[model samples]
Target: MAGLAIPTWDPETALLIGTILLEAIVLYVGYGGLERIVGPRLLKLVVGGE
Candidate 1:
């Protein structure tokens, strides 16, 4: 508990963190769509099976 320190809010830090979160969400959705389109075929090819 002694080592733990809570972060104080700063507008710039908040905006930066928000931007990173947005980017992560967008990337997740984009990759998910790509996976849905071709993931099974890719897995089969890697596994050497139909």
Candidate 2:
């Protein structure tokens, strides 16, 4: 696949790298927000109440 192929001096290669980086950052932030919102409630449930 082209994606698995070696890097080239093509402009398209630069675009692909930028897209992947943005996706990674977005996913990381999304998961962090989810953990913050669910963390305390889940902890209380498992710890048998506050």
Candidate 3:
């Protein structure tokens, strides 16, 4: 454990990580928007609500 070396920053790895993070954020926002748009209609259809 004492001989272990700390990892250094790699630009490629940083870019990959950043892209994944951005994709996750985009997906989250898109899903939330779709849910807000569709959820109530789906619930009404299922529960026979007016």
Candidate 4:
């Protein structure tokens, strides 16, 4: 099937895949940073404590 065909190396395909990977990495890091900044406070609120 065409959908199951092995990918051919192409600059455009490489760039598109690289961009998606980069975006995923960036989102992961950003969310991790935000969690580090706010996670404790959020947890405290949820658990109802000081």
Q: What 10-residue stretch in candidate 4 is worst by lDDT?
A: 1-10
Task: Give per-residue CA lDDT, model 3, range 1-50, as digits (tens).
Answer: 78698889899999999999999999999999999999999999999989
Candidate 3, pairs of clashing residues: none
Model 2 vs. true fold: TM: 0.71
Over the stretch 1-50, how does candidate 1's per-residue lDDT look in tens digits?
Answer: 79689878999999999999999999999999999989998999999887
lDDT of 4 at 2: 62
- Cα misplacement distance, residue 45 of candidate 1 (Å): 3.7
Clash pairs, candidate 2, are: none
Model 4, TM vs. native = 0.76
Q: In model 1, which residue pairs have backbone atoms overlapping below 3 Å?
A: none
Judged by lDDT relative to the true structure, which candidate is superior, 3 or 4?
A: 3
- Per-candidate RMSD, Å: 3.1, 5.0, 1.7, 2.6
TM-score to true structure, per model: 0.64, 0.71, 0.85, 0.76
What does the lDDT come to for candidate 2? 0.91
Report, for every candidate in turn, its global Cα lDDT versus the true structure.
0.95, 0.91, 0.97, 0.95
Task: Indicate the residue-level lDDT of 47 in model 2.
Answer: 96
The C-alpha stretches of model 4 lying farther than 4 A from their native spots are 1-7
Ranking by TM-score: 3, 4, 2, 1
In angstroms, the error of model 2 at 15 is 1.0
**Candidate 1 wrongly placed segments (more than 4 Å):** 1-7, 47-50
Point to the candidate with the largest TM-score: 3
Over 1-50, each residue of candidate 2 has an lDDT whose tens digit, in order, gives 56798655789888998999999999999999999999889999999787
